[model samples]
Target: MRGWITFAVMSVVTLILLAPIFNIVILSFQGPQTLSGDPVWTVDNFVEIFTQTPVLTYLTNSLLVTLGTTVFGVVIGALAGYPLSRLRNRFARGYSLTLFVVQGLPVIVIVIPLFVVFAAIGLADTLSGVAIIFIAGSMAVTCWMMASYYDSIPYELEEAAWVDGASVFGAFVRIVLRNSYPGILSAAIFSFLVAWNDYLVAVVFLRSESNFTLPIGLQYFFQQNSTDWGPVMAMSVVMLLPPVIIFATLNRYFSIGGIGGAIK
Candidate 1:
């Protein structure tokens, strides 16, 4: 009876969470009949979204920024994380504390200074410029995440590699990096999503229509035209695809495993 009750509760919770997503899906497929406050179904709106909106451009920008942020974040994160994880130095500890504090500073609070600095340096309103800012913004969180992952790894693996005619770099490659794949991929996803979802920074720094990311572009679309619910829902559905794909692609690495494979 308890198990059945728990199952009923879980089913209700799942439906509640999925309701909005289902609404979006239904709304995306809705057509001219749906326009009259009646829920009608058709594929035309989705077709028109592809035909009409500069959606591909916005999607491309999102992809580019996500890729750039992920690479920059993961590479820098691993490098910075390595020292922080293994070092016993006071400076490293102090810097780690400072990094945590910086992470707590919300993105909205920093946009003003970034705008001034980027414009002065002539990086404002450019794709590369957006990417650079995103990299810096994501690096602190990435470093902390990577450091935690590294902490879970045994230092002895690195030591063993060093004993086997390996330099620090070689040991890192052979031992640490091999074990860091899941963590690296996870960090990449986090950074990519952060860059992709950033609206405030994009709004402040990106003035050109061509450079506008999907989030910024979506806002512009809504602002410019009378309410076009069809294309709006279609674009939303497309925009949500990346995070789903990324999480699904990376979820393969996470699993329960026992050392040397024994049932305890």
Candidate 2:
């Protein structure tokens, strides 16, 4: 009876969470008739977006920034994380705390200074410039997350690798990293989402219309067509797809038995 009650409660919560998503999807299909109280479904919103808008360019820019952030963020996190997990010195501990502090700091607080610096260095209004911000913004959280995950892994595997003539770096690569797939992927997803959903940073640093990301482009679309609910919802749906695809594809790689099984 308790199990059934819990299931009922969870189902209600799920519905509540999914309600807005469902509403957006329905609105994306809303045609002229639906707006005028006739209620007919259509793909005109999608058609309009592809045909009349620069959605593809915006999508491409988002993809470039997201992919760049994920790659640099994950690699840097793993490299920094290994030391934090295994080191015991005062500097390591202080650096770890610094990461937490950086992660906690709001992006808005640092973006203006970052803009000044980037503009001076000639990186402003460029995709690479925006990607650098995403990488920096995400790296602290990624480092902490990867470090915590590495802590859960037993050190015996690396010790054994050392006995077998492996260096510390080799042991980390072959044992720690090979087993830290879930952590790396989680960090990648966080970085991807950060780059994907960023509006404030993108709008501030990126000036050219060609360099605009999906969020900026979506906001511009809304500004130009405030009453066009269909395309607005459709773009929202488009923004939702990459994260879903990423989670779905990487779900299989996140297993529990990589190094733990070998430890015993």
Which candidate gets the maximum TM-score versus the true structure? 2
Going through the candidates in the order shown, the clash numbers are 0, 0
TM-score of 1: 0.91
Candidate 2 residues lying further than 4 Å off, grouped into runs, are 34-36
- Tell me the tens digit of each residue's lDDT in model 1 across 1-264: 999999999999999999998888788888666445786788787787688878889999989988989998999999999888999899999989988888889888988998899899999899888899889889998998888888887787767767778999898776777777777887888899889999888889999888889998888877765466877788888888889888887788655321222111
Off by over 4 Å in 1: 1-7, 34-38, 256-264
Best by lDDT: 2
Indicate the TM-score of model 2. 0.95
Clashes of 1: 0
State model 1's lDDT.
0.83
Residue 106 lDDT in candidate 1: 85
lDDT of each: 0.83, 0.90
List of clashing residue pairs for candidate 2: none
**What is every candidate's alpha-carbon RMSD to the true fold?**
3.0, 1.6
